[model samples]
Target chain A: MSLSLENVSAGYAGRPVLSGLDLAEVPSGSIVALVGANGAGKSTLLRGIAGLGEAKGRIVLDGQDISELPPEMLVGRIGYLPQALPQGSSLIAYEAVMSAVRAARPDSPRAGGAAAIEQVFDTLGLRDLAMRRLRELSGGQRQMVGLAQVLVRKPRLLLLDEPTSALDLRWQLTVLETVRRMADAEGAICVIAIHDINLALRFCDRLVVLGGGGVLSSGPPATALDADVLRRAYGIEARVEACSRGFAIVLADHALSLDHHSP
Target chain B: MTRHLTALQERSASLADLYGGFIRNRLIAIGLLAVGLACSLVLDVATGPSGLPVADILTGLLDRDALPRGQAVILWNIRLPYAVMAVLVGAALGLAGAEMQTVLNNPLASPFTLGVSAAATLGAALAMALEPDVPGLDETWLIPLSAFACAMAATLLIQTLAGRFGAGTDTVVLFGIAMLFAMNALLWLVQYVASTDALQQMVFWTMGSLARATWEKVAVVALVLAACVPLSMRSVWAMTALRGGDDHARSFGIPVERLRLRVLLRVSLLSAAAVAFVGTIGFIGLVGPHIARLTLGEDHRFYLPGSALAGALLLSLASIASKNLVPGLILPVGIVTSLVGIPLFMALILTQGRRP
Candidate 1:
């Protein structure tokens, strides 16, 4: 199975943020990191793919044009986690996840739903927090619950917008590792809009970097990330060095001149 | 590895058991609320000024001929309608408030937040001031009839505006607040030019009373609420998702905008039916959902019914208080609700502030 985007233009309020974007054959069972600076339309692209925002063009998943499908048709098939964590709900985490499962797939039998929710809570290692109200959970814990909400659906295409923005280092790794496992085990296509480039490099199979309202580069992280790409995309002079364990690590030097840059 | 698997299985079993217990507890709470509501209804019907005995109230409810002729007439016509109307109107407002609060993502958003009550008040004021002469229309019935019409009109206007300017919480809430202010200003203007007698009537109507409740009005509110509760329950999971916020709800493939619009429409219907018949009974709409949330949590399965039951209980108790507040003078039910509800609402808010 593969996902492809052709000449996609996504934006808010009829203003194009990402225009004429294309990606060929994003095979299933792969994790792709969507990395870019702020205002780089990383979120717009994700929202566009998730069909939560306006987009014009073709997003084909598994030989079907998913972009044309109704939002309800995307349930349990295209899971999205917004940048903001779930908040202020008096519902317990268990009920929150169970409700998501029931909402997305109302026709599914209740017995199966209970087991599915239990499995997700087990997978997230949040069984202890399951009975706690969302408002009682910390930011990281709530973020985890939000992740559990999407993960319980077990979508074919997971679109996460800054899922780890509020999480600490260990929790961030836990999230990415869970995504990686989903891609490998379930063949889910995971595209994460993330700011932590090093974490992305370490965890993701491929990096789809955006700059200047378009794709800057798309390849395996080791090949796609470099000094030139970093300078152009993020307006920073940085070094792409291999760590002792042969992992790519970015070492930033200084900010490049941004006088003429619109990004 | 064998021990790890066993541990995993055991933990899953425990979690599943915990979830079962949680659901059972919520159901029990709902059952308790229902029982409480039933008791309040009985108490409301029993505690009236005519000095009817509780045994007579019970016997009259079961067998109309058990009471003396005048007592039977009072029980069946006055006490029964009043008590039943309290429960129905309270349930309507409570369920409407619960949906409004969830869809708007605002704890303070009650049925009146959309200006239905305000518009109803304006209609009542106009009816009092103008005293429109319609052929064959009862002079006393004009106020509630006009109020119901104006409330429905405001609902349509709000619905149109929601469709026009995307039904996000902010747009709907801001427009509703704007409508509320506009209606209040119009009501004041109408009251300013009215005769002293009309002014007095307007003031009394704004305070809201169940004194005018008849079997017909009771049926109207009951019919609307009966239609609404099932519809609210149908959207329970979607509303539950909405508590996670719009984006979270949308991600679950729940159309958040459309759901908000539909909920707003339903809430408008329930609130209009309630406030039109009963006048502007405040606090029940705001406090009912909070009480439900405190007792039953935000699972709309429980929350919706819990809110409805809580509202019914609160109003039923308030109805009893309205009758007994003074020795011979029955204070307006709305006055009792406000006087009792304000402290309860404040306490809930303060306790909520201490939570994460």
Candidate 2:
């Protein structure tokens, strides 16, 4: 039982952003990184998987062919943290997390039960600030709260869009580490759309690089993080340094000069 | 060291316990609503043109054979329908207001902002002015039906304008304000065309009165309100998702446009029905939802029902107070609502500040 996309094509308003994309199998209990530049259709792919957008392909989960299911039923098995965390004026931190869990199970006993709620708060490290209003929190704190909300249900399939965009350095590391731990411990399939290439190389088991509305490359970081792939996708001439642990992409001076000269 | 660590853990556990206790204590709010309902019913029956004892009122309601004919007629035919209409109209307005707030994601949004009451008033005035000279026109049913139709038309117009302008809250509210002015002008034109008697009647009706309440009228209004409230409440989960903003709602698998349209239709039905019967009662829709939010927090499940109950109690109490304020004369219910609700809302604003 795993997640797979077969020859998927999707976009908005008849304009195709992702065409003929195929992923045979995404292993359960693994962190898969989706790396792309600004307009590389990474967000669109995640949206299609989450059933937020229309796609002309089959998305099979546990071999049940869930491509045609309504979003409410799909939500039971999948948890999604969108790219933006909306700021609600009146909702407090604890209430926001509770709402997400309630979305999955409107009448679930786990939502307001003392034991379940306490466990969520303790795991998220939100015990001290549980009573604080959402308007009072900083952007990074709000992002963490948003992430914790989707984790409340511990869904089988987790999709995150730019989860660490608003986080500070420490919180970024903490959040990525938590995502890794969640996938490993719970046997859940996790797909994260991340802009930080180094974090992707460090944490993800495999990388899917998208460029210009299609898949540029997909493989282990050691194989996919080559200079030619970076140059084509990011418009940058880069040097790939292979190390004992892994590899890193260092942008050359000419790439930096070209970036500065671009309109 | 172990004792100190245990003490710290105990304090954290106690704080979580307190948070749980506070939310579970929602029963207190339900109790308060029950008490308010009972008090309003007693006062509504007791304080009228003819004063009756509480025992006699209860006996009249229970055992129809036990009361005098005059008291029974006054209690059953007059005050009972009036009280019932007050409860229904108040509940509809409050529910609609809360739904609007949630749908628009703005605390200030209400049915009145969409010109619903204004359009209904204009429609009623037109019926009164234009149908008098025609052969055998019954104003009672014609006026309310016209009001309902016109209010629905106004709602559709506002929705169409919103769609054209990208369906944002600011555009919808702006269109509503424009429609209010347009309806007000039509109402003024109707007044200019009316005969002396017709004009006076229109003016009085516009001011609002529960004295015109009848059992049949209350039944129709009650049926419309009852149908709309549950349909609107069913959208509470969607409304909560929408409160997270449009993109968030979309990501959560909600069709943003469909949800907005559903809420708009429900609120329009509720507002049109209430305004058709009550003649544009103000402030209850605006103030009722605010009070509910302050007392019950912002969960629409609790907030919508709480607002309905609180609005019913507030308006019924206002009607009772209006009757008693002058010994022999009665003020229009709308006047009383404004006079009582404005100062109370002002006080609330001062105390709470502008907190969404």
Candidate 3:
């Protein structure tokens, strides 16, 4: 029910993007926000845990090392959703999600009854669009369908790589709310890479700020997302504030002073 | 509560029917194409050099002893075997083309896109030119064996390229096209250096004739086709996941590269069996999948068999055209396939309302 990454290094083609990154225990029934600048190994870290990248190190889930597990073994417990949605599929949203459900359990009988796919569809407010082909759906709708694919698996450890990048405001809130509800209700450990600081601070139970290919600060959002960490990680001078209702938020007023190096 | 029960029953019934409808529609398409192939088989048998009487052919099929000796030889020896080869070869090419397109995620991908047929042609031409009587490779089977080996070699090269440079779209297709051009150049070089008789044999092999069909050859190809197809059906579900794209397939735990490797090997075997028997018969491997996609969509459960049947129908009909198109002479089935396939392909594109 708890997830811990001691030291993980991963990259593409032997060039390490994330170098010895570490995150302490993330307890069950919590949302951990992962925020970092571009090329700070956000997606790579998520993919590495899913056994998709060239990763080396122990990723202990409830004290069991999953780093060396084969893809088929690791896949049953971990679910990772990438940033870009798959394109040009003629399958309807319902069929697409059903296919994923079947694929996630290749050994079992295709026990994901139509109701399972339909339940996810209805939960995401996609009942009206369930039968629509994936290629025909808009970006936001496709992103929602992608989340349904992962949620259908009901993995113990969930990783979302910028899940809200293409979502509209209402659906974005709905999706994050669903993630939190799944965490609290199902006791799943969820880590989401996000760009929106206010939503992350408000919804997430803990924050892990990534910088220089590793965690720059780690604590509750109020303690970890200070001006120093924001300047170091995002290279922007920012301030953390609380709204009148006491929900935390981040406001960036100017770009921080830094040496710019162009390749 | 009773009202709710009825609604739930109706909803679940409709859900079952949704899947049932998919299988039913695919079966109907297969049935229609199967009937068309049956008709083409009859035409192929009835309209030959020494055309057998249709009444006698039918009666002979029902009772082998009912056929007169001359008519029996023509029906059993020449036309029946040729007709069977046409369908089996067509089906093999069609299935290979369907899998190739699915793996590459390119609608235009064909069995020949990876240079399998071209490599086979080059291998066959080399066998004719050099007459390498490789031991254990039967003299009669040398050309085909050589061709199959060469086609498999091309597949291996593409597999290596795919492994080295990511297995996503365009890597294998680009490498295959490169091999195609290179093989064509090599095939021409072999043709240039050959003597008159060897050159004639090589040229005729590339033109793709059904005149070489025999009962034994038909049975061998049929056996290969039979073994290749059912094995492919097992992978149809994984291939279905692939239609959503490699990343999507992988996320669902489908091994994309491994699936591609296995399917590509199956494709090589199918295409090599086909062209080895009939030379480089064109169009079936290119258009069969398109016909299937347009008919059954991208689901490989139906798409694979649908493609196979459509290819069978096209090639069987083309075999008939090869005989009837010229009153005095039977043109090469390869030439007739292009003559028939181009128009059929154009109609499919026009009716499908999409640019190919």
Q: What is the interface RMSD of each candidate, in Å?
A: 1.6, 3.2, 3.3
* Cα lDDT of model 2 by residue, B81-172, tens digit: 98888888888888888888887888778878888889999888888887744456565788888888899999998878777765667777
Which candidate achieves the best TM-score against the true structure?
1
All models, DockQ values? Answer: 0.69, 0.26, 0.43
Q: What is candidate 3's CA lDDT for residue A74?
A: 71
lDDT at residue A49 of model 3 (Cα atoms): 78
**Prediction 3 TM-score vs. true:** 0.91
Ranking by DockQ: 1, 3, 2
**Regions of candidate 1 where Cα sits further than 4 Å from its true position:** A109-112, A257-263, B1-12
lDDT of 1 by residue, A67-100 (tens): 5666666675889998865667899998889888
Considering chain A alone, what is the TM-score of candidate 1?
A: 0.95
Docking class of 2: acceptable
Best by lDDT: 1
Q: Model 1 clash pairs?
A: none
- For model 2, name the residue pairs that clash: none
The residue pairs that clash in candidate 3, if any, are none
Alpha-carbon deviation at A81 in model 3, angstroms = 1.6
